[model samples]
Each structure stands twice: as structure tokens, then as C-alpha cells.
Target: MSNTVVNSAGAGLVRAVPALVGAAGFALVYLVSGSISSAFASSPAPQPNVSGEETRAWLIENATASAVQAVLMLVSVAFLALFVGAVAAITRSADGPARRWAIAAGTAAVASMIISAVLSLLVGGLAAGLTPDAVVALRTANFIAGGTAHVALFGLFALAASRIPGMSRPVRIFAIVVAVIAVGSLASLAIYYASILILAGRLLGMVWCVFAAISLARRLKQFPPA
Candidate 1:
């Protein structure tokens, strides 16, 4: 097999590991939190006679889910690192529009990772003092930074992946859709549901990441080690 194929395969494998892991983490957090929210909505409002212990217990229970979300957040950062590494490795073969996009995507990945780390640190510091308003403010910032990064990185990935030889047409089309979604999500940031839109965009972005990894892996397998 050729060097191109080998490189692509390695990149793909590296990329896939984090994506699958992150997706699992995301699913776990989503399910747990959504369930809790549903339960809370269905339950009766607190009675005037309710004890302090009961309230504390409720908070503790919610905290458990929050802890799970924190773990998922860290896993997501790991995935971003893997994505950046894969893009760096594959960018060498890219030229023209593809090369430019790779560079931009790699840079955005790095920025996104950095911002995520910062947000995590901030949340940890404020965890004890967290109120609904404070959480909303922090989450707003996180969504803005995260959404911008996703748009930049995914847009680049779509452009670069579309140019790669042997990549399937469907993968290219998916990339295009991801790029469009990212842009639209960014535009929607001015609205109250920005977080929701951004989350949706990131989910779509994950699909593109998986496609990229598979394509790169297939290329790599076609090329053997020298």
C-alpha cells in the first residue's frame, strides 16, 4: 500500500477513538440530566413543611448528575486534542483550498481546546457558589466560544475532506452540511436558544469528525509502512 493510505488510516483510527468515547460520554450525561429534569417537572412543588434535609438531599442528587457532566466535559477536550493531531498529520498531503482549510481547522481546534479548559476551570472554581443565574452566564460564554470554534474547525474540515482522493461523495456532502450548520448556529447565537442551537451544531460536527476518521483510516490501510 502507499504512504498516503497508511497515513490516512492512522489518522482515522486516532480520530475515531476519541469521537466514539466522547459520544458515549455525551449520551450518558444527556440521558441522566434529561431524566432528572423530567422528574423534577412532574413532581409536586415543595410544601411549606418540607425539611432542610430533604432539600439538601435533592441538591446532592442533582450534584451527582452534574459530576457526570463534568467528566463528559473533560472527555470532550480529549477528543478535541485527538482531532487536532489527526488534522495535523493529514494536512501534509493537502494543497490549495484543502491545505488552507486544514491549517485553519487545526488552529481552531487548538483554540477550542484552550477555551474549553478555561471554562472548565472557571466552573470548578465557582461550583460551590453556583446559582441558576451564574450557571447561565458561564454557559452562555461557553456556548459562544465553543460554537465559534466548531464553526471554524468544521468548516475547514469540510473543505479539506472534500478534496481528499478516495473519500466518498456522501462524506463530502456531510461535511458541507456540517459547515452550513455551524455557520447557521453561529448566526443564531444572538437568540435565547443559542445554547440549544450550538449543541445541535456540535452533534452534527461529531458526525463529520467520524466521517473524516473513517476516510483517513481507509486511506491509511491502503498504504503499508515503508
Candidate 2:
């Protein structure tokens, strides 16, 4: 390849650095949030079908922690959004289905976060004023948005990344698996025990992001300008 092509590829890799950082940030912040919330809790948080009074008391008692968790989630979502946009740019520069797939993935990724984001703000900022019944309702909605729905839509990103023409076999296969786990997590909506799928998809998606970003950088470096 010519020096010009090499330089272009190098520039692409540099531009991709944000996506790498964003992916890492998304995972790290989310982990920290979970850890902090768990650390402060005296008992396991209430689940769906728990009494509204019990849920309300739990929220009120943990109001500060809930706010902190919400703030962290917002930050993580911002990082994930950055990752989606940056990766989409990289895919758009490549040939084949990558471009279209990335766009769809990016769209889904952002859309998935909207409900979670809005609900987070409400839970964090308005928990004190919420009725017991409202607490139960919001809590369920929060779980659905941040848990199942988020990962289900995020699976599209993994699926799209898997299609990038020159991605390594392992990364592509892993991305596909992550996508399946993530998209399949939708089953949890009906079969409550299947929430394990949501957990797997959410956590594995982070790992996939890191690997995919590295693979994307490597692929960009290897390919020359047409």
C-alpha cells in the first residue's frame, strides 16, 4: 500500500480510539454503579410483585443510592452512545453490508437507552414523591428498559459488527453469539426465569465491544484505500 493509504488507515485507527475508551467507560461505570448500590443495600432490592408499600419504602430508604445509580447509568449510556457513533463511522468507511448494518445498530442502540435514561432520571429525582403504587410501576418499567429492552436492542450492534468484512473469525463469531444472547434476552419478558439471558447478554456485550473495537482497529490498519 502507498504511504497515503497507510496514513489514512492510521488516521482511522486514531479516530477509533474514542470508541475504545467509550466501551471501556461504559462497562466500568456500570460495574461501579452496581457495586455501589449493592454495597449500600441492607437487603436484596424488591422485585416485581413485591408489595407496593415495601417497594416504596425501599426506594425512599435508598433514595440517595438510587440517584447515584441513576447518574452512573446516564454516564454509561452516554459512553455507549459514543461507542456506537464512532464504530458506525468506522463501519461506514468499509465496503459491503457493514455500513447499513452499523446505522441500524446505532439507531437501535440509542433508542434502547431512551426509556432507561428517562426512567432513571425519574427514579433518581422523583422517588421521594412517588406513591407506593407508582414506585412498583416505575421499578418494573426501569428493569424492563435497562435490563431486557436495552440489551435486546444493543444486540443489533454486535450483529452489525459481525458483518464488517475483515473482522477476525473469533471476533465475528463472538459478536454473533453476543447478538443471539442479547436479542434472545427478549424471552425474559415472558419467562421471568430467563432473565439470566439478559444478564449474560448485557455483560457479554461489553466484552464484545472491547474485542470488536480492537478487531476494527486491526482491520482498518490492514486494509488499503481503494
RMSD of each: 7.5, 2.9
Candidate 2 per-residue lDDT, tens place, 52-105, comes to 888778777776667667777888888888888777666654757775776677
Collision pairs in model 2 = none
Off by over 4 Å in 1: 1-68, 95-97, 127-137, 194-196, 221-226
Would you estimate the TM-scores of all the predictions?
0.60, 0.86
C-alpha lDDT (0 to 100) for residue 70 of candidate 2: 74
In candidate 2, stretches whose alpha carbon ends up further than 4 angstroms from where it belongs are 1-12, 39-43, 95-98, 222-226
lDDT of 1 at 68: 42
Candidate 1 clashing pairs? 1-223, 2-223, 5-219, 5-220, 6-220, 8-216, 9-217, 9-220
lDDT of 1 at 35: 57
- What tens-digit string does per-residue lDDT give for candidate 1 at 78-125? 655556555445444444566566657756754774575466456545
Q: Measured by TM-score, how close is model 2 to the native structure?
A: 0.86
